[model samples]
Target: MQETRVAVAGTSFPAVRQHLEEMLPGAVVEAVPVELLRSGGCAAEVLVPAMCRIDAAVIDRVDGLRLIHQWGAGLDGVDIEAASRRGVLVANVPAGVGGNAESVAEWCVMAAIAVNRRLPVLQRVLRSGAAWGDPPGRSLHGRTAGIVGLGGIGQALALRLRPFGMRVLGVRRREDAELAGRLGLAWIGGAAQLPELLRQSDCLFLCLPLTEATRRLIDERALALLPAGACVVNAGRGGVVDQAALVRALESGRLGGAALDVFEQEPLDPASPLADRPDVLATPHIAGVTDSSYRGIARRVIENIHRLHDGRPLLDCVNADPAGAQASRDS
Candidate 1:
């Protein structure tokens, strides 16, 4: 029997390889540099695209490529239509499965508070030995928190924010009355009600994935709708918010501050204006990179691999019809 060839794209997160090797002792697991993969130098039966874009070109170049599994929830980089057409199975470990959602939610809470309290300004004040209490901060209590995307992370955030005495307002692709009632949300609406949510919220939380509809969802107009001095905390995809428009809003004093964990570009360029702004608290997309999340993700990946070998259905498959691909391969 030939050993399964598993190629993990990207060099970051060495623990993924470690976990895979420990679980699948007989499999050949190797970390393929993202640069090499982009250059069409990787071939594997199973590919874990860790923060690497898997476009049609890369998909077609690789031989014996059966699966393209993302290490975590974000699959925006993968060209799903092309993968489906090529009979390649694409799957992802959804948020909340392995404490990823909770971890990200925790980060969002911290960020909201940090921005509200003018943490960066305080830090600078302390560093410069400035007068104590030079700048005042706002409190989270009794403020309206508008959560866009009501998915796993959004739901987690709502639950966590309840204890902070915040009035939670949620906007999801679809409104779920039961879920809203369960989360004790002040109001829940669909995409169409986003503007209303913005107008009422004291803080805006972007927790949705980046899709065609959601890309630049919070453009200049949307930002303008937000109450003046309202803070923004984004734990979701960076593209969901218009970076340029956000900069304009912040610079003009239309918005209070922003806490951003993800950006339009990973490893945000140091030269970018968003990098050094005192009002902008930036993190390098580490909201969901906790040990518990990775371990849960690794276990799911391993299970799917075993299922593929056993001719069973894959878990969390995003493709329209993965069985079609499996049948094509078998035939």
Candidate 2:
């Protein structure tokens, strides 16, 4: 039997390769760094774009590519239309399925608190031996927290924040009163109500994906809607907020601070102005990179691979009909 080839386009290659090999002894998994993959040097039956962007050109370069499986829920980086045109299947492990949502929710909650308390400034003060009470911070209690994108992660965060005595407000693409009631959110509204949400939020959390409609959704005008000294926390795709607008708001003292886990650009430029600011708390996009999430994600990936081998329909396929694709391949 010929060995099945799998190419991984992000970090944790060794661990993923080992796991897949152990489970499917006849499969050959190799790491194809994003740089190499972009330069048209990938040849595999399955492509796992863990943290890499798979565009139309890169997809065309990979010979015999059948599947483009994302390690987590965010498939914004993949060009689903292009993959479907080439008869390739694209799928992702949904946020809540792999503990990814819970992990990210925890990170968002921590970030919200950190920015609210001005943690970065406190760290600097401690190191500089400045006055102990020079930079007083506010408490989460009795403050309004507006969560955009009421998906798995947003819903998880809402539930977690309620215990902190926060008045949680959620905005989804559509309104879900039942969900709001279940999560104990003070109120829930649709996207059109974003301006209302912003005006009331003491701390705003962005947890939506990046798309045409969402790119820079929180621009200068939107930032102007926020109450002065309000903090911002972003665990979603970086492009959802305008970096320049955020910087201006922070610099002009219009906004309190920001905590960011994801950036518009990966491997954020070291010399970027946002890097060393005391008011900005930055993390390198590891919100959902926990052991619990990875284990569950790996199991799902393996299951899809096995399904592909057996001519069975793949799970969570976003583009292309899985059953039809499998049948076409068999024929």
Candidate 3:
């Protein structure tokens, strides 16, 4: 029996390695860094990484590349159009609720509370032993929350926000979302409903994917629609929000503040304006990492591979083609 030959485009942490070992007992695994990938000298049939940008030139360089698997759900880094032309299969593991929903919701919720209650302002006053911080604050109860992209994460947010007694307005594909009705989401009319949602929402949470349609969905016009002192919470792709626009909104007091877990540029530079803003709270995109989420990630990746290897249906296939590379016999 010939074992499957595989390669890793490197991973962020060790749990990915352990899961890969458990999933593929005899397959060869090489954790090559991005520089090695750029060199175009290494040999591998599969490449998995947290973020790997595979363009037409890189695809040309990969002599015998078959599949590129993104460790997480987003595939913005991979050139899907070029990959489709080249017949290279790409996969993303967004199958069974990528554990990001709850964690990201938590961050957004915390941000809303922190900003509404002026927690950061109070902290500064406390440190200086100043008298009576008098920043106006709002309560979550009876407030409106606009959740964009009512997918896994958005649905989870709706569920979580319900306990707060807040009214939730959802904008999604507008197709029949069976789960949306089941979850009791008050469906907004259309994407055009965006302005109305922003106008009414005390906190606007973005849970959308970054597509051509959704990129910078919250631009100047969108930000201008928000009620005064409203907060913006982005847990999805950072490209969904225009960074410059957000900063301007914050500076102009058009928005009270923003809580961000992901960014347009990751591992944000200390010198970045967003980092320096006392009003903004930012996290380094760790909203979906925990021992449990790791296990969930492992299970989804392994199951998909199992389906592919055993002539079964591929679960959570992100790439246009799943078998564009090398197809193996059933195990």
Candidate 4:
């Protein structure tokens, strides 16, 4: 039997290596650095890409690559079409199993409350030794929260918000009447109802994925629908919301404030206007990245590898190609 080989691209993260080693007892798990991956030095049966570019050029060099298992949920960085053309199966750790949905949910709710309460302005006032009563912060109690994309993170957020005495509204691909009743969503509808949902929301949470249809989904028209002074919290792909339009809305006071964990261009340009705004809270993209989440990701990778080696079906195969997975069966 040929010993299985796996290569990971990123700064050396020991936990992932340890888990991969334990799962594939005698197999080799090489921690390839970004420079090497970009230079086409990694040649392994399986590739684990963690926040590294896996473009078509990089894919062309991996001679016998059978799988491109993502270390996290986001596949935006990967060249899925390139991998598909080469018959390489691409997979990711879905929400419930990875435990990241809960972490993201907490971050979303926290941002919503933090921005609405005007934390920065209040802190600045007290630090400057000025009286604090002039700027008031709003409470989540009795307010309506509109959540777009009722996926794992959205469902988790809806559940978490109930205790705060807020009404939850959701929009997704289809209206799940049953899920709406169980999740206690005040109302659930499809994309057409988004305008109404925005109009009613005091806090709007964008948790949708970035697709061709969803890119810039929340632009000037959508922001204009938001009730004046409404707070926006985005834990989803930044491209989903029009960053330029958002800035204009905030500048004009049409939208109250925003808490953003991800931006259209990451390491968000220092010169950007949103960086220093008191109403905007911008954090590096670390919403779902936690120690626990890393471990969960390792487990998902292990499970998929086992399935691939044993000729069983892989989980969360986004680009479901029979030939890609069947190659592993033949191996």
lDDT values for all models: 0.88, 0.87, 0.74, 0.85
Q: Evaluate residue 266 in candidate 3 and report its C-alpha lDDT on the 0 to 100 scale.
A: 71
Tens-place lDDT digits, model 4, residues 61-178: 6777889988767788789999988878889886656778888898988888889988878778889999758688899999999999888889999999999999999999887889
Give the count of colliding residue pairs in each prediction: 0, 0, 0, 0
* Residue range 1-331, candidate 2, lDDT tens digits: 3578998876643566666677667888888877778776677989988567899988987998999998788898899999988888898898878788999999998888888788998999999988898688889999999999988889889989999999999999888899989999988999999999999999999989888999999999999999998999999999999999999999999999999988888878999878989889999888887777777888898888877777788889887464765667744
Error of 2 at 148 (Å): 0.6
**Poorest lDDT segment (10 consecutive residues) of candidate 1:** 322-331
Better of 2 and 4 by TM-score: 2
TM-score of 4: 0.88
User: For each candidate, what TM-score against the reference?
Assistant: 0.93, 0.93, 0.84, 0.88
Candidate 1, residues 184-242, lDDT tens digits: the string is 99879988899999999899999999999999999999999999999999999999999
- Per-residue lDDT tens digits for candidate 3, residues 7-119, read 66644555676767776788766766667767754666666665546677666666566566766677888887787677666777772355756666666777778777777
TM-score-best of 2 and 3: 2
* Model 3, position 193: C-alpha lDDT score: 72
Query: What TM-score does model 3 achieve against the real structure?
Result: 0.84
Arrange candidates, best lDDT first: 1, 2, 4, 3
Q: State candidate 2's TM-score.
A: 0.93
Clashing pairs in 3: none
- Runs with alpha carbons beyond 4 Å of true place in candidate 3: 1-15, 21-30, 60-64, 95-98, 119-137, 175-181, 311-313, 318-331
User: Which pairs clash inside model 4?
Assistant: none
